[model samples]
Target chain A: MSAAEDRLPPLRRSSGSVGRIALIVLGIVLALLLLVAPLAVIFAEAFSKGVAYYARNIVQADTLHAIWLTVLTAIVVVPVNIGFGIAAAWAVTKFRFPGKKLLIALIELPFSVSPIVAGVIYILLYGANGLLGPLLADHDIRLMFAVPGIFLVSLFVTSPFVAREIIPLMQSQGSDDEEAATSLGAGFWQTFFRVTLPNIKWALLYGAVLCNARVMGEFGAVSVVSGNVRGETNTLPLHIELLYHDYNAVGAFAAATTLTVLALVTLGIKTLIEAKGGGDPHRPRH
Target chain B: MAGALTARRVLPGFGPTMGLTLFYLSLVVLLPIVALALKTGEIGLARYLDIITGPRVLASFRVTVTAALLATAINAGIGLLLAWNLVRYDFPGKRLLDALIDLPFALPTAVAGIALTALFAPNGWFGAPLAAMGIKIAYTPLGIAIAMAFTSLPFVVRTVQPVLEDVRPEVEEAAASRGARAWQIFRKVIFPTILPAFIAGCTLAFARCLGEFGAVIFIAGNLPEQTEIAALLIFIRLEEYDYPAAAAIASTVLVAALVVLLLANWLQARSQRHSEKTP
Candidate 1:
């Protein structure tokens, strides 16, 4: 089979070199324009006002706070998602039971939700006129237009990444390893940590990387719940908006450059992990 | 052993883990959706109908749906071309090209919006050149489509790339040996293989475009009846404190999403079955 495949080569290999060259040129140019130029523009604009100005604006208290908030949100959100991802993946994959498919489908609903709709839904559930609004008010509690609200909305949008990555892999791997470990007298946690977790580590990291990228970039729902509280709830993306609106183009683009780097790092890690996974790596999503 | 375990739920913590998953899923996802449904319910059926049928809401829906459809269609073709190039050819920066395709997923939508708006604005890079030709982009519905197209292009490319990679050369050689033309081989052999991924990717792109807010808002000009998207209309209603109106629009989009989600699920299942049949 391998020898026959080698003999055949690929159809494209036999095509005219001129046609191939033209297609390659077009592909490269399009990719550069659509994918690469955006990063260049953000950096160019950021440093247009000079590096000192860009650096100064980036460290401004509110801008720093926005950066901090973005990181903090991801920090909290990623782990919770990691935990939920683990639990859900375990429940559905390791234990095949009634309603298993339904459970999997429901976990995916968060991905289907429009971020703005997530915010709107939260508002209906927690706004002053909402279902639990009165109850929250009675206790002098707040969840909307606050840090907690931002976190919750971020949680809703990002909860799916980790579980979606791990579950399918675990399902395909089956429970043989775990069953083997159990037979060998390992405790449940021991079997899980040694056998299951080690095997799925790359997928877990892959999912976490995507999750971190998203939680940081999340703008739509965060905008609704954040209320654009400068030095407060404004995450990096929202802060970039605030700067742009205030005509601080340099500041806005500078903040945007930071986010661009974050995205680049995420893409880097994602690529590296996928490379490590070697075989057909399961494609993770945004 | 496998049969015995399957028969009796041999796994430990099934109850606890399952409970936590259900509770979290319900609280984080299902409840909010349920609350939106309930909120829309209070507005009597006539008022509910009236809210969605309002001039502003109607206009927003048209812009959103039309722009999304156009974007998905555009991405479907371009994304396939890009994927085909990446998989079938050897080129420098090929890895970079592949990595960069995922930028849309990684980059913040707001950043994407501004980058696109800046690039297409009159004073911006591509904008200045296009302006000489009287081609306006930013602050236009065309700009909205571009942003939607940018954010969604990855879906089609990623989905189709793997399928393309898995298409063995031997399969194509068989057709070639039959004296088939390149185009015919592509149509008969290549196209059918990738069609399912293309459909799957297009659906995701369409669904995503429908909800796209940050990227679209920056470029769309938000010209209420002309350029505003459905998601923006929901945000606007909340800003105006018109809860019922927002919920009404939300109801329409949610219903649409559920349908699309269902369709996507069915497509995925069908594709899985197709692959198993052949492989």
Candidate 2:
């Protein structure tokens, strides 16, 4: 049923029923071509052999290691990003500040940056001939071509997710609740936990989900710093590339299937939260 | 500084939280971008320009810009239509289509790349039939554009959807009462409102397409100077241990991205100004 609020007066009647139908058809066709087809292709290509074969491809040592590393990266990166996102949002929205706009733009810098360049810059800082290369080498502290490198690049790529989500939500929410709680003699920690945290928890998880999604699926940046050392530094996306390059199309597709499933789970939860409608952080974006 | 002194909120943790936020932001985001710029600077102006403007690099730049433009153009039309439908019309599967629009945002880039390649590769499903018609998609500039279009599709739609949603139908009704036709009503009424957002969305999509590496590289077949994208070329430079060359080329993308981001921000600020004044 059309929303009565959205209904046009007879003067502004929609392009008749036929025009509406045409646009809906266009929308469906575009969605299928862009969204559904890619998803279907991944699933079909994965099962071109059989579920058993797909399982075998993913169960191998190298592939498993890639999966583990991807998850490990997310486990480290998501919380740190969550911390930064919360801190940034709290700082910008909860208090009066100067250069708040500049801070936000800086926080969102990675969003505009290419993953390839994001990787390269880290290399510039820590690679063999990088600025800290000598210091790192002397300490035998490996940053490039290691898990730390993967962790860092993923952090850069996803840094904005949680903060971007929380900032607008908090801005719109204002500091009213925190102020009230504080006036009632609530301490900083108490106000945060009792008054503020509950309000933004869903948004928090929402951002974490996005951060985790990007963490696992990040390719270009991680690929740059990873050196694609199979089973050592390869994340799931890099593992898929490795499989494809080795002419193991099935293996690649299988790995792709795993990441595809993760994407779906992320989408599922995001949709559920948005549907629940508790001050959805996604509202500002769309 | 004046605002901090004049405006007071009882909320605490600003100092601690903001301190951490600043420090972390510097470490991860600002510092890296600065490092990128600094590394490029260290190579000197003449050499950097030479490396960035070399024939192979120039050809890759041409391909990247052209493909990104093509993709952005396609997305502009389709995304406007998609946003219009989702906001104005309610239909069967509307929710599904609406949710799936975010799929590109969620899906791994490599997956989209390979999947598109599979669909358009010779001996594959769509590829075989298209090949019969002499329309080679895989491993061509068209293939790169297709991947670019797919990965960046959501930006235009998402950016415009909320703006479209906020527009009231009453304006269109008033226009129609004045004898405005459907097309005229949209052009004179609805289109003007969403124009800033549309431009913002298109620029965002264009920026994303410029930086896209995973999806396009898979489908483009990485034929340097023909279909090679700038991002992948930079990666290849890194692999060759030509760090100076990679940094120089990568900065061009950074510049493109910064321009687009500035456009988006300005458009956003304009829209926000409009929103604040609306009621």
* Backbone atom clashes (below 3 Å) for every candidate: 0, 0
Question: Model 2 Cα displacement at A74 (Å)?
Answer: 0.8
lDDT (Cα, 0-100) at B217 in candidate 2 = 90
Against the reference, the lDDT scores of all candidates come to 0.87, 0.86
Q: On residues A1-286, what C-alpha lDDT tens digit does candidate 2 reach at each position? A: 2575235643234445677788889889878877898899899999999999989998999999999988888889999999888888888888776787788888888888898989999999889988778999999999998889999899899999998887878899888788878868888799888998898998888888888898889999999999888889889999998899899998999999999999999888988888876435224231
lDDT of 1 by residue, B57-117 (tens): 8999999999999999989888988998888888889888888888998999999988888
Tens digit per residue, CA lDDT, model 1, A134-241: 999999999999999999999999999999999888988999888767767787678789999998999899888888999999999999888888898899999998
After TM-score superposition, the amount by which residue B248's alpha carbon in candidate 1 deviates from its true location, in angstroms, is 0.8
* TM-score (chain A only) for the predictions, listed in order: 0.94, 0.93
**Residue B252 CA error for candidate 1 (Å)?**
1.1
TM-score of chain B of each: 0.94, 0.93
Best by lDDT: 1
TM-score of each: 0.96, 0.95
